[model samples]
Each structure stands twice: as structure tokens, then as C-alpha cells.
Target chain A: MSASDYESASKGASSDVATFDDEEKGLFGRFHHALHATPALVPLIVLMVAIGIFAIVLGERFFSPGTLTLILQQVQIVGILALAQSLIILTAGIDLSVGAMAVFSSVIMGQFTFRYGLPPAVAVAAGLAIGTGIGAISGWLVSKVKLPPFIVTLGMWQIVLAANYLYSQNETIRSQDIRDEAALLQFMGIRFELGGAIITMGVVTMVVMVIVLAYMLRSTAWGRHVYAVGDDPEAAELAGVNRHRTIMSVYMLAGFICGIAGWIMIGRFGSVSPSASTGVVGNIQSITAVVIGGISLFGGRGSIWGAFFGALIVGVFELGLRMAGANAQWTYLLIGALIIGAVAVDQWIRKVTA
Target chain B: MSTEPILKARNLVKRYGKVVALNRCDFDLYPGEVLAVIGDNGAGKSTLIKALSGAIQPDAGEIWLEGKPIQLPSPIEARRHGIETVYQTLAMSPALSIADNMFMGREIRKPGWRGKLLKQLDRKEMERLARDKLNDLGLMTIQNINQAVETLSGGQRQGVAVARAAAFGSKVIILDEPTAALGVKESRKVLDLIQDVRSRGIPIILISHNMPHVFEVADRIHVHRLGSRLCVIDPKSHNMSDAVAYMTGAKEPDQHLETA
Candidate 1:
């Protein structure tokens, strides 16, 4: 529009548009500014408030180290998956195959150790590679082939799920066999009592991941590129960012993280089963966490820590409701309301124009 | 005014299906001058600049930068050759802070081990440079350098975009209607900005529909017509009506200033 023949654009910047500062004068306005400054704060606050309510109602028993650590352990799998999901969603893309990829990767690790007689560590490495390879395929399709991530990952989810059953023959590597031979495969399940709380290796891994990814997103050039590509690919391209490379790496990195989750999934479940339907259920669980975490599905708007808080929020709700003798269905009802409320708040925060 | 042209385009031709966007169009930009490109809707000014900025490749043409023929297959390639373009969209990430947007692709890294091994960004230095550039452009009203671009007013955003171009556009800067999305006061600031950038000795190619703005900042006006350059008129010699008449074909130059 360098040589716009009509004076169409100048008409937009009138007195009304210039009056953006006028509206930012009250409590709601301050909240809007705070949310705009750090979107993840909303999920963090929600998680704390939920915990406070549960702690007050259930007394110190509910807030004890044992119960708190149990919450971390329960959320380990979904927390890791949501980390991967958060990266994909921040780029305005969704990875429907995330769950299938993790499950399929676990199946590969278990089968390779048994079928090929490879070292347990080697088998674990193979699983991570397969996970990353699956991500690369999805990334290639989305970044280079320009396919919509939704469709690509949806098709990938089906393909990977079917491949899991076919390749693993729906076999279940029992906990007994794994514990006997592949003690290394269950390394993430190794637990220790720290100050009367049982902390699993899987929880440690998730916390470390959240910290590293959060730092990378805030302090690295690559992280900035991810947000830029997600925010506006064309803009990033014109600004000299290799948009395709950025997106391709994001998917690959998400895949690598998912691969790690798969390894941890073994630790969490203590078994590698091709028919573990819980892995399939992980897809929706991660998305729910991300939405409630205040990460805009539109992309490039939330913190990775928000996803961690999001997963914790769900874990807290489930445990709190159960301890209060509430029905399991009540958890769903409340989470559904939170999802809607989160999106509504996101929209409100977005309306803040300085 | 008699020095060699800094940027020259010769016999450029571009077509989209049956539509001829630029037919035998020619352009020349001298150093340290604001060259205003004025034309009607279909006069091919947009296409002409796109070809020059490497947004679209002309079917047949030779773009000479500093008297050397260069091929710009992509905008990145054009930027590498020290030609920066501030597009109509401003090409900025809205969620990013002003400092991040300023140093989008060419971010500075911390010195020493952390820089080499961990690849840490020099956020402090980048923010400082960004603030300096904005300050140089008299855009210091922005309170926080860390504020996201989306929070800034439209005029302030434009100021940032222009400042970015001026800071890094070493050879030439192409501004696509920089003031079109701004109010009267904002447009006035941008006009001042164009003059300020020109004062720093970098040539600019400004395309605008505002004839008064065109006349105000322009040293030479390139009037585009029928998908090509009609003539280059001195803004000092011609008024707004004359430029409009030349562009709309109501009148033509007595003799076309075809070449620089």
C-alpha cells in the first residue's frame, strides 16, 4: 500500500481511536494492563486460589507435603504433554498426534528392548528419536508443504495410533518384565522421600523442563523467533527471520519434549502398553490445560509456565473435589466453566490497546 | 544533483496473467533525496516498488544498486544489500516488546562464554540501542521500552517502524504510505521524520496518495501512469494540482524526464 491511490487508511486514526488512553483509568483497566503484561499470571492466580480454597476446606491434611507431592506426581504426564502442546499452540498450530506419538514411542522403546535385544538405554534413545521423527514429519508438512497443522496432526494421530497397534501387536510389556530387565526404562519412576514428600524423577524432569523452556522463550533468539513466527509468519519473514526453519524447529523441539514425556510415561505407568488408552486421552487433557492456562489458541500470547500452572490447576481440582466427596462429573463441570471464563478473559485482555 | 544515481531500474516489466502491472517502467533514486512516487490506483506504482524491494520479481528488468546490477529474488536478499522496506503492515510482531521487534532477526548476543556456548541474547544492549534509535528520532514519549508493540498507538508504532528503517536501512529505505494510517498530527510527525532521515544522507522512496504530503517532503516526484513512469517532475517547480494532472493524464510533461 505504498502508493495507495485512495486516502482510505488515514480515516481510521480519528479522535475515537486516539482516545485509547482514556479508557485505561480504573481497576478493570489496571487488571487489563497486568494481564496484558503477563498473561500466564491469570492461570497462576487461579491455581493458587483453587489451592487456597481446597486447603481451607480440607485442613492441613489436604495441603500436606504428601498430598502436594502427589498432585505433582499425578500431573507429571499431562504437565509434560502440555509443555509440548503449549509450544505448538503458541505458534497458532495444534498437534493432535502428540499423545499417539508419545504412546507409539513408548511402544517402540519396549519392543526394541525385547524384540531386538538392544540395551535398555539404547531402546530409550530409539524411542526419543522416533518421537522426534514423527514431529519432523508433521513439521515438514506444516512448514514446508504449508498444510494446516490441525489436519496434519489429526491424520498423524490416526496413522501413529494404527501403527502402534500393528507394530506392537497390541502387546503389553508388563511391569514385572520391565522391572526385571529394563530397570533403566523406569528410571523416571525412581522416587525419594524429600522432607516426608515422595518426589518422582518424572516430577523433577517436568519442573526442570518448565524452567529451561521458560528461560529459552524469554532470553534466547530462537525463542523470540518462535513467538514471531507464531504471531505473524509474513511479518517475521520480511523481518529477516527464517520462518520455515523456526516453525520446523518448534515442532521438532516439541516432538523431542514429547519423546521425553513418553519415557516418563513409562515411569508414571511402569508399563509400556500399545493399548494404553490413557495416552490417547492425553490429547484433550493437554489442550484443556493450555486453554485454562490462558495461552491464546490464536498463538504467540502465553508463557510456558502458564501451561504448568494449568496442568496443576486441573490436578488440584480433581483431588480437591474427590477429597470433598464430590462426584467426578463435578470436576468436568467446573473445568468447562473455567475454560470459558479463561477465553473470555483472554478476549478482554486483548482489547487493551495502549 | 548531478552525481550518479544510487538506485536505478531499467526497462522493468511485470505481468500478472493478462494484466500488465509494470510495462517498461523505469525508476531512479538519487542520494540524500526524498523521491515521492505519485500515481492513480492502477498506475503500477505499487508493483514498481514491489519489484524494486524484491517483494515480487519483474519478468524482465535490471535493478542497479550503486551502478552494479543486482538480483533480488526475495525481500531478505534485498535487505542484505542494505535496502530496508517498511511495508504497510509494518511487518512487526505485535506481542513482542519494542526492543525485540527492533532487533527481530539481527539480535545481538552476549559477549564471552555465555554468548558462544549458551547463545544468550544481549537484551540489555538491544534495549539500549532501540531506545537510542527512538530517542534519535525524537520518539521518547514511549514510557517503557519493554512494552509490547500492540500496546503502542498507531502513530507511535509507525514512528518505531520508521526509526527502525532509518537505523538499519544503510543504502535506501522504501516507505509504503508511512502516514496513511496516521492522524493529521501523526502525519505531520512522519513528514518531519522523512526530512530527518533525508538529512542523514540516505535516499528514500515514499509512495503516498496524499498529494499535499507528496509535495511537502518530495524533492522530485515520479508520476506513474498506465503501468509505467510518465515523468519525473521537480516538486519545487510543480504544485499539487500539477502532480495530480500529470498522474491522471489530464496533462503531460512537455518533455518526459525519462532518465536521471
Candidate 2:
């Protein structure tokens, strides 16, 4: 056999994606093939299919410009959370603290608006800064203390939950207090007509984040380092990539994304509860979307685009089920099945490629 | 022969608690030569290479790169001194593309007025360089430079790792049992590549247990028995059985053999 055959065999064993004949394609074709062949594409395509089916079922109800904008607005907060979770999962770790951290940050923002009486903009900024600080501390504990991510993040989740309750004094902050800061409240409220339908500012934030994150993963050194650390920390270190530093940055980015999600949540709901979003089940949905979108829990294998499509798929599924008169129980069953099917497909794909 | 050797380790020693790994090991590597280090499982061959590669600091010894005595703090320090190593497992991230693995931490930047703003990878240049380097060793079968290393076979992965070391301008290429995972035919192909590298004036430190392949390519052979050097011999002077006997500590060093 020739050397190319040997190289192709190695590539197949690692990626599970069949190598395309380089002779048949140039640069653009190669990149096209790369995108199509990515494991994450399966879920993304599935999401697009779900969207089409939903629009057909709901007709103008789902496809109307207003409905489309609503879908974007509704998915934006969970989408950000999913993106944050993707970063952690890509490192073969999880941050159970994300939901609690976001909730805690919201409570802190409530304090800024109600107790301290800070400007809404300042309150928002302070709330986000607190989230960032907590994230930095957690990152330090994990990387410096060499704690298992699961243990550290789990402990952090509980700690933040308790902290949120204590700060809010187990009371729901009034919507009036939060809305008084017009600038802060309008951050996610900025709406304009798009093809005769209003689109919220939340959609813009989600779109920009998706683009920036996807570009970073593809082009930047830090992005490469993230992949490297997730792949094999030992090999990455041998290559001069600092594993600790990369992991710290990943957690920080995860925290920052959670802060964005919290910001959207407060803007949309106009209130903060110590236990807000407790029964929403958005975390499970977001994680399931990520898995369906083809981001591997094994780390170093998925992209933010996958996270985007994953979120879209979840949103479409929920909207479709609701239109079909499906109860909350049936929606849960459907989501559970999708997650299982996605995981099963991922395993099958991995085995065949290996 | 024309100049001082590229890398030398004298009195190198290492121990893990009560277990000694490397014991006063002295080694010399010259340009355009393949020094085959052959031994049994517990012969301290790996320990010596690990110390030399700076994966583990020696308990007592001096490592001289280009005739300068320097302490190698880590693998990065060793690489900085122009020493590249290919471990038995290949030590490559299977998820990354071949070009990405080739450049890795040292990627070539695309030519642009703005450095970070337009800091795209010089894809054409990287591919061209990779292809040329592989072609120089007559490896033209690999068609796609974008293919991930996980897609390649054991022998192909071996070639990539070796190609990377050569491409990086390594003064000494330390390969730890490169053919340990290959089939006979594939192993022969890698052996041929080793010969090609030797022809190109790149010294190789080949660590392997296979005696026939070692004798086939190595000009000089060193045997280690129980963490210490038993004898250094020209492959032409002794056959496979003699080398094994020395490595297993079943025979004494013959005085007639040339000593370093």
C-alpha cells in the first residue's frame, strides 16, 4: 500500500469521518467536505429538518416573521447557557454550577437595583463582574488545587445556590425595582420590525456570540489550545501548550457566557428569584441540545455552531410539541428519546470509525 | 567524524525510590549516524532516553548538546536545544489535522500587513513544506494534508511523527520503539525511512527491542542490562544471540570489542 493509504487509515481510526479524495477537491471543496463530515453536522441537519417540519405544521403561526423572532428571543438565553456548557463538556468536564451561578448573579443584580439603588447599567455590570469573579475563583480551585472538575463544580453549584437564597433573603425581588432602570431593562428589550415582525435585541446577542465563538475556535491560538488540552493534556504540554492556563480560560469563558445568559433571563422576566428557572428544566434541555448538535462529551470534538443548532432543535421540538397539544409529560418523553437516540448514534459512529 | 557529536550523556543516573532506572549511562550521538539502543524489558533503555529527552531529570549526570553542558528542565527545554522525540504511542492528538500536528505550537503565519488581525495560517506554504518533506523521503501516497492523524495507520503515523521531527530541524531525533506497533511490512517501510533520514545527515537515537531490525539499520549498538551499559558493539561484530545474551546479563562483555 502507498503512504497516503497509511495516512488515510490513521485519519479514519481517529476521526471516524471518511477521508475525501483530495484529487476531487480544492481548498473550498475541502473545507466544505470538512464541515459536512464533522460529526456535529448530523445534529445540525436534524435541527434544520425539525425547523422545516415545525414551520409546515404551524404554518404562518410558526413561520410568520413575528413567530420567528419570538423563537429567536425565547432560545437566546438557553442558547447562551448551552454554549457555556459546551466549553466545559468539550474539556470532558461539567459545570453543574452554571445554572446556580447564573441565578446567584441575578440575585446580586437584584441587590444592586433594590438595596444599593445603583443605576441599572451599573447594576448589570456589577452583577456580571460578580459572576466573572466567582468563575475565576472556581477556575483557580480546579486548575491550581487540581480538584476534579465534577467535584469542584458540584460543590460550587450548591454553594452558589445557598448564597443566592441568603442574599435574596428567600424573597422574590419585585419586577418594578428591576424595570426602573430603563437602560438595563431595554438591553434585551430593544425591538424592531423585521419583515413586519418585531425581533428582540437578544437575537442579535446570540447571533454575534455564535459567530465570534465559531471564528475563535477555527482561527485563534487560544481556540487551538482548548482543543489540544481537551484532546490530550500530556501531549499538549509536550507541545508547549499550557494545559492549566487553557483550562482556566475555558472556565472563565463559561462563566462569562453564563453571565450573558443571566442578563437575558433578568431582562426578559423582569424579576429575580433565588429559585428562578428552578422548574424550567432549561439546563437539561440545553445539554441535550448540545449532545444532539454533535458536541461530544469526550471533549475536543464539537463546535459552537453545533451548540447553536442544538439550541434551535430543542426550541423547535418544544414549539412543535406544544402545537400538537402535547402535555409537559409528553414533551419530556420526546426530549428523552431524542437524547438517547443522539447518544446511541454517536457511539455507533465512534465504533465504526475506530 | 568531521566535528564533535551533537548530543552526549555522561554518568547519567536515575532511581525511583529503591528501584534504580539509569546507572551511570554514558552515550554519544554523531551526525549522519543511527545509534540503536537494544535491550530486554528491564534493561534501563527507556530511563536513559527519558533522562536524555528531559522527560525526567537524571539523578546524577550531565547532558551535553552541541558540546555545551546544560540542565534540561523539561521536554520544552530539550526541544529548544533541537532535540525531538517520538514516543512509542506517537504522542499525537488524533483529533487534529496532519498539518496542525506538523506545525502544532509553531505554526507558520500567513504574510499580511496586520499580524493578529489577518493572522491566518499560511496553508499553502505549510502544505507545500509538509508535502516536500514527505516527498523527500519518497512519501507521496498521503494526498490530503488536512487529514487528521487518527485516520492513519500505525506505520503512517510513525512516518508523520518522524517527518515532523525532521521538518523541525532537530539536532537529535529520539524514537522510542517506533516499530513496536507495526506489522512486518510496515516496520520495514519505517526502517527504510530511518535509512533515508540517516542519508540526509540527521542522527537518530533508535530505541527498540527487535534485534534483526536494529542490526539491519544501526551502525553502532549499545546493550543495557539492569540499568547499566553492558557493552557497545558494532552490529557487524556480533549476531542477534550475542546481543540478547549481553542484554539479559547472561554473558560478560568481551574485552576485544571496541570501548567508548
Which candidate comes out best when scored by lDDT? 1
DockQ of structure 2: 0.32
Off by over 4 Å in 2: A1-36, A112-126, A140-146, A278-282, A351-354, B1-3, B113-115, B254-259
Displacement of residue B146 (Cα, Å) in model 2 is 1.7
- Candidate 1 docking class: acceptable
Q: How close is each model in CA RMSD to the real structure? A: 4.0, 5.5
TM-score (chain A) of candidate 2?
A: 0.86
Write down the TM-score of model 2's second chain: 0.93
Question: Interface Cα RMSD for candidate 1?
Answer: 5.8
Against the true structure, what is each candidate's TM-score?
Answer: 0.93, 0.88
Which lDDT tens digits does candidate 1 get at residues B73-174?
A: 888889889999998999999999999999998989999988888889999999999999998998877878999998788999999999988999999999
Interface RMSD of each: 5.8, 7.3
Tens-digit lDDT track of model 2 for A205-278:
88988888887777766777788778887887776666788888889888877777777777677777777873
